[model samples]
Target: MQSEDNLLKVLIAEPSAIIRNGLSVTLKRIPGSWIQPVEISSIENLEHVLETNKPDVLIINPNFWGYVDMTTVRAWSAASKLKIIALVSSLSSDVILKKYDESISIYDSPEDIKEKIFRLFDTSDTEKDKSSEESETLSSREKEIVVLVVKGLTNKEIAQKLFLSTHTIITHRRNIARKLEIHSTAGLTVYAIVNKLVGLDEIKDNFTL
Candidate 1:
């Protein structure tokens, strides 16, 4: 059980106003608590609300995941204390929100939803800053590759420049993704700039995603 002083804050997101209103009422009534339920009928304001209100849990429509960039989601997931619970409609939805804190079926009964929210308090682990775990300390060669990639070198081009095989360059790309947990060129551009692998002015126009 959470501390008595802690508010039972939940942000219920659903497309249907009727369904969202119903869910807010049902969730607010889960016993022995100071109920604080906020309904989000659209994802456009989600980023702002999440940053400002800082709710304890975020119960979102699974489709909401598709509306934003994974980079945005990754940044939010990295910083937010709120436990994310995706309302899954199918097995595929699970894949969409796989990195979320928890997932509950849309078809679950109110009681089940209550239980799952309560359980989040128990099962939720304190997430350290993922940069520590996700962004591995690159080897000197890896750093070279990052700099080269940021300089707009294709895998074949980089391999030839470095006197390595194309296959080696491809493996390095995969390893870089595994370490950074980011794959898009845009995301990588930001990473490279922030990490000082390359200065912002050094980035070529063609390097954009």
Candidate 2:
């Protein structure tokens, strides 16, 4: 059994009570009591709840971004290593979807939801070991690409700087994403900062979703 301090705090922000409660119930049935979910039905209270709860993971609807931008939401939980997962119910543009660390469809099965959430945490010993191994396999070029990416450089910009073709830069980025298992620019930024590949000050003002 996991200790209390090791529990994963999850905040579910959805307007519908049924969806919020359903997600909470699904999370609870994951065998271990390591996940502790807190649900809120209003987007207006999101910032306050985020500040107070400091949850490890946030499962929120993308529509809330219309009221609160991704950068602002990230700022409120800057103290914690927060992972924002979009609780998508309707069609969202690719640009909007890429801002989040992950996405879960409303129609996803309970089992699928559990898997997606668990993979983010990677709590199992075997999974942790595999992740560690994969993390170590990043090439120096890939590391450079990751740094440029976190610095808000477009693929074309990075290609120009590195004297490489745009196609090559895109390929490198794809490989980097696969290696790190992080799909979004926001996620890549966090990884770069955490891994000391880029300093926070370098990207604080310039970083985008």
RMSD of each: 15.7, 13.8
Q: Which residue runs of candidate 1 sit more than 4 Å off their true CA positions?
A: 1-5, 69-71, 74-79, 89-91, 123-209
lDDT of candidate 1 vs native? Answer: 0.67
> Considering summed lDDT, which 10 consecutive residues are worst modelled in model 2?
131-140
lDDT of 1 by residue, 1-209 (tens): 66645877788777777767877887777676566898887666676677677678878776763555445643554235567777654443324655665555544456657766766565324534442343244545667888888778899999999888777677666556655778876777888888888987788675654
lDDT of 2 at 154: 93
Segments in model 2 whose C-alpha atoms lie over 4 Å from true places: 65-67, 123-209
Candidate 2 similarity to native, TM-score: 0.55
Q: Write the per-residue lDDT of candidate 2 for residues 1-209, one digit (tens) a residue.
A: 77878888889988888988988998887775478999877766777888887888899988863645778888888445688888876656657766776677665556556666666666545576774454335556678888988888899999999888787777666556655678999998898888899998999977754
lDDT of model 1 at position 86: 71
> In angstroms, how far off is 106's CA in candidate 2?
1.3
**lDDT of all the models against the reference?**
0.67, 0.76
